[model samples]
Target: MRIIDAHQHFWDLEANYLPWLTDKPVNFRYGDYDAIKKSYLPADYRQDAQEFELAASVFIETEWDPTDPLGEVAWVNSLRKRESLPSVMVAQAWLDRDDAESVLAAHGQTDFVRGIRHKPKAASAPGDVVPGAPGSMGDPAFRRGFSMLAANGLSFDLQTPWWHLPEAADLAEAYPNTQIIINHTGLPADRSDDGLAGWRAALMRAAECPNISIKISGLGQKGKPWESAENRPIIRDTIEIFGADRCMFASNFPVDSLVGTFSTIFNGFRDAVEDFTPGEQQALFHDNAARIYRIDPTREV
Candidate 1:
């Protein structure tokens, strides 16, 4: 099917995104985007999607850039100069900032800046919910910042563990107009502690929120000995419960590539979506992104 990867990330290895790709001791640079140059860019991602039909990709923020909050926005802006790259961007922001409205307004002016991701962790450590550890998203100040998102015509890409369902739910209720996408299946929860049932319950709740959407991404496929076939079900269940209109497909790319190939990841996403009709597939892979992000594929920029 024709595809529009709703959630992917790119890091210019030799440019501004390089510093964030350091070793684990200092930074979280371990076989991530920059390290895997093959399918991390428009040209490369397109080439990598040769096995499948990937028409475009939405580039999400790799991480926060302290010196430049607009670093990801700048990256996509630069790409627009070079190529018709990264159709959309889910950039980062200090949601706790009082100037959050202006911050989003400025960034939203950038052609590809379509969404915001403030890391929030709802699970214990050893889980994939790093960056913002335990209860960072629960802060009321962050909720206030989120309130301004939809007003500026930007969506919020939520990256919290499944255990943080109540918190994610609260954010959705608080900002009824804002669009929130559950990142990485609530980060897979803690396999040893929270267990699948708890995560599943949280996911079921996430599906209920009208303003909330879930991106079917296999980025968190590993952390276990299972293969794509095994991991596909969790994401598939999410889609099946959430339904096609509420669900979208994504690559999560290099981060996911650490677990499987780009094609493999997309294929896993495709596999989960196999039951979806052709039109449903279109919605999942292309139209959903275009509609939700208000993507103007014909726009020159």
Candidate 2:
């Protein structure tokens, strides 16, 4: 099937100081991430995704040098100039920064930047209801920074764990005009029945806001084995809660690669949605991402 990978990352270890890849403590949820610590540019991504028909992709910002957020954006745009695969950019920004407006303005000046993903989650105890810095989202300054997105014509890519989905719902309600794309299926970190129940309920609440759409990606981040049958309920429930119109699928690549191959991830996604009609499948794999990210038409997959 044709696909528009709504969420992927392309990083150059030599050009940028990515703490996650270099000599610094990383906050990734999964273990043994050493396998993917090397650079992952568009060429690597294309090779990984070659088994499937990948129409386009969006370069979600990786953890780069926060000192120069625009630098990472420029680097990715430069890559796009060479390879047209990653057709959209979701650059990084510190929403709580005092000069966030200037940063947002800088990001706005870029050609492919369609959104901003301010890191929201902070390290927290396992089984903690709200992981990450809970107050960051509601902080006056952060909200101020978030408020600037609509003015700059950019959407928000929320990367919070499941516990924060309720607050995300409230944030979405507050900014009815601004688009909020929830990352990682609301990040269901807990796979237990009770955990899934909580995630499902929170997702339903978030979906109540028409402006909040969910991107189904990053499922294997928490050390779970990549299996389509195991993910069917999560995928189906997310689509059921948000409806297929407000949902999109992504390869989450490189990061997800730590757990499984590109074919394993995308093929699993394809299997999860096998019961849906072809049109619904089309939306999950391509149309929804293209429309949400404002992807330009390119050569057909």
Candidate 3:
């Protein structure tokens, strides 16, 4: 089947300054990301995704140097000029920062940029959530910067945990014109029964906002390999909650590669939705991303 990978990344560690990959390792959820610290440009990604019918991919920001947000967009634009695989990008921007407007304007000037990703301040656990905290999604200053997206014709790529989905829902409600694409199924790393129950309820709340959509990627467990049995239920539930039109499939490649091969994740998604009609499957794999990200699948860029 044809595909538009909704969320993936490419980084040149030697040429670019990705502090997370270069500096002393931070407490990464995937644990010890040293394996992927090396450059993963278009060629490397193509090799890993060679078996799949990948029509195009969206390059989400790889936490490039925070001081130079536009620098990352420029580098991705350069890559697109030569490689043409990442048809579009979700560039990095800190919504709560002082330079947010100027940075967002710079990104808007780039033709290939479709959206912005700023992982809002999240509570460590569900109970710790404090609404309207500074830098959190509800922060007045953050929302002030977020309000700028609609005028720029850019969407928001949110990567907060599921516990924060209520805040996400409120943000979506407040900014109905600005599309909010939830990354990684709201980062549902907890798979226990109560955990999933909370996740499902939170997802349902986010889905109620018509402007919100979700990418079903980054389902990797800390120690376990990416398996359909472990993720199929979550995948199916996400699609059910958001519906095929609002949901899309993604590799979350290189990062998810820590858990399994490209085929393992994509194939598992395909298998999980095998019983759905071809149209629904098409939306999940290809259509939703193309429409949501404003990608021209036929253009080959």
Candidate 4:
């Protein structure tokens, strides 16, 4: 089936923003010495996606240094100039900034920018989710940024820790006009903790919003196992709650690859919904991303 992965990331240590990679697992180092480097240009993602026959993709920002939003946009866009990148970039710029328009304008200079995401769940320090943080989805500054996106016809690629789903959903409740796409199905876990049950319901309600879409990527990549067939039901529950039209597939790549292969991550998705309709499968793999991000997979990279 034709596919459009709505999420992917690329960073080079040569860039000022990439010092963050040293903190990442060795698998994610893009170009650091004494670390495994990632060849994360469009060619790399394009090659890995070849087996799945993806038509296009949306790129989300992995680095979130809010200190320099415009600089970050220019930096990521610069990568596209250096090589033919396949996906549109979702910059993690200051949606909450008073200058949200200018920040987006910087990204708009490029053909690849599709959206923005500054995950609230991120700990100020790495390796854990921070509770009660102001993620880009709901901050007043983010409020203005989201408006900038809607005005520019861009989507918001949202990633939050498991705790903030209800608040994120509450934000969705407030701004019905925003084209919100939930990252990692709001990141449900195999073993529930931290008010996960309530988070699931919040996500379900947000899915009911016609404007919202969900990226069914990044979950297993966060490191979980199905153990047996019993764990398969979570995917079903997501589909039933969000509906296939509102769901799309993504690799979240090297990050998710930390836990599973690209083929295994995707095949696991196929396994999750083997019983669903081919059309549902189509939406999950490609159509939803194309529709939500407004990129043609058939376009030349």
Candidate 5:
């Protein structure tokens, strides 16, 4: 089947500063990382996805240096020229920063840019890597940055943990005109039954807002079991909650490479959703992403 990977990334180690991917002493959600620390480019992705018919992919921001956020978009735009697979680009902007509107405007100038992702994971308890104070999304400056998205004709990608979905829902409710996509199937980091229950409940809450959609990717976090059998339940549940129209599958690429290969992650999604109708399968793998990202699905890869 032809598939459009809804979320993935490419990074040049020499050209960009990706401290999180390389910096030692990092407490990544998944424990050890030495496996996939090298540069991951489009060619590498093509090789990893060799077993499947990869129609297109969406290149998401890699959270590069905040000072020159547009640099990441420019660099990825160059890649998009050389490789047609990443037909869409979702750049980053520090929404809390004062100069966010200017940066967003610059990003808007790039034709491939469809949305912006500012990491909003709040630090609620101790030992959280990216903890934010309570109600950080409600801050005046942050909301101000968010308000500018509609004017720029861009969408928003929210990446907070499952617990923060309700807060994200608040923002979605406030700005119905803005399309908010929840990344990583709500990032269900905790695979335990109790943890999964929390994730499910929060996902339902976030889905209540019709404008909010969910990206069912990035399920291969650290320490999680890496197999289709393990992912089947949650994958099915996610599709059930958001329904086929609102849910799309993504590879999450190099980040998920640590858990399994591209074929493995994507094939697992296929297996999980095999019972759905052919149109539903099309929606999960390609149609939904094309519509949401405004990409011409017929574009040559």
Candidate 6:
């Protein structure tokens, strides 16, 4: 089947400055990531995804140097001009920062940039959530920058844990025109019964917002291999909550390679939804991402 990977990344550690990869190792959610610190350009990604028919992909910001947000976009533009893959991109924009307006304007003018990703401040646990904290989603300044996205014709890529979904729902409601794409199924790392229950409830709240969509990637667990039996319920629940039209599949490659091979993750997704109609499956694997990310599958990327 044809595919449009909704979320993936490419980085050149030597050519660029990615603090998390290049600097001293910080604690990572997916365990040790030293295995993938090397450059993963278009060629590396193509080799990993060769088993699948990948029509295009959405390049997400890889936490590049915060001081130079536009620098990442410029590099990706150059990469796109040369490689012609990652059909479009979601650039970085720190919403609460002072330079948000100028940075967003620069990204808006870029032809290949489709959206922006700024992971809002999240509490360590659900109970610790402090609403309207300085950099939290409810912060007035952050919302001020967020409001500017609609004018730029750019969507927002949100990557917070499920506990913060209520805030996400409110943000979506406040700015109905700006599309909010939830990354990693709300980072559902806790798989216990209570954990899943909380996750499902939070997802339900976010799903009520018509402007919100979700990418079913980054579901890998630390130290565990990707398995359909373990992930099928989460996959099925997400489709049921958001419906196939609002959901898309993504590899979260290189990062997720810590848990499984490209085929392991993509094929696991296919198997999990085997019971759905071909159209629904097609939407999950390809159509929804193309629509949400504004990627033209027919374009020669």
Which window of ten consecutive residues has the lowest lDDT sum in model 1? 23-32
Report the C-alpha lDDT of model 6 over 44-142, residue by residue, as the tens digit: 999999998888999999999999999999899898888987799999999999999998898899888999999999999999999999899999999
> How accurate locally, in lDDT, is each candidate?
0.70, 0.83, 0.92, 0.65, 0.84, 0.92
Q: What ranges in model 5 sit over 4 Å off?
A: 124-135, 298-300
lDDT of 3: 0.92
Poorly placed runs, candidate 6 (over 4 Å):
none
Who wins the lDDT comparison?
6
Please, what are the lDDT tens digits per residue for candidate 2 over residues 138-200? 667778888899989899999977767777777888889899999988878778898888889
Q: Least accurate stretch of 10 residues (summed lDDT) in model 5?
A: 125-134
> After superposition on all CA atoms, what RMSD does each candidate show versus the true structure?
3.8, 2.2, 0.9, 4.6, 2.4, 0.9
| Candidate 3 accuracy as TM-score | 0.98
Clashing pairs in 4: 4-286, 55-297, 89-112, 96-141, 96-142, 120-135
For model 6, give the 10-residue run with minimal summed lDDT. Answer: 292-301
TM-scores, one per candidate? 0.85, 0.94, 0.98, 0.80, 0.94, 0.98
Candidate 4 local lDDT, 77-194, one digit each (tens)? 6665666464567877666656778877766665667777765535322234443346534556656666666666566777765455556676776777777888876766534554
lDDT of 2: 0.83
Instruction: Output the better candidate (2/6) by lDDT.
Output: 6
Per-residue lDDT value at 201 in model 3:
98
lDDT of 1 by residue, 132-250 (tens): 44336666677677777877788888876576776677778877888888876676634544577777788888777898888877445333322566677677777777888877877
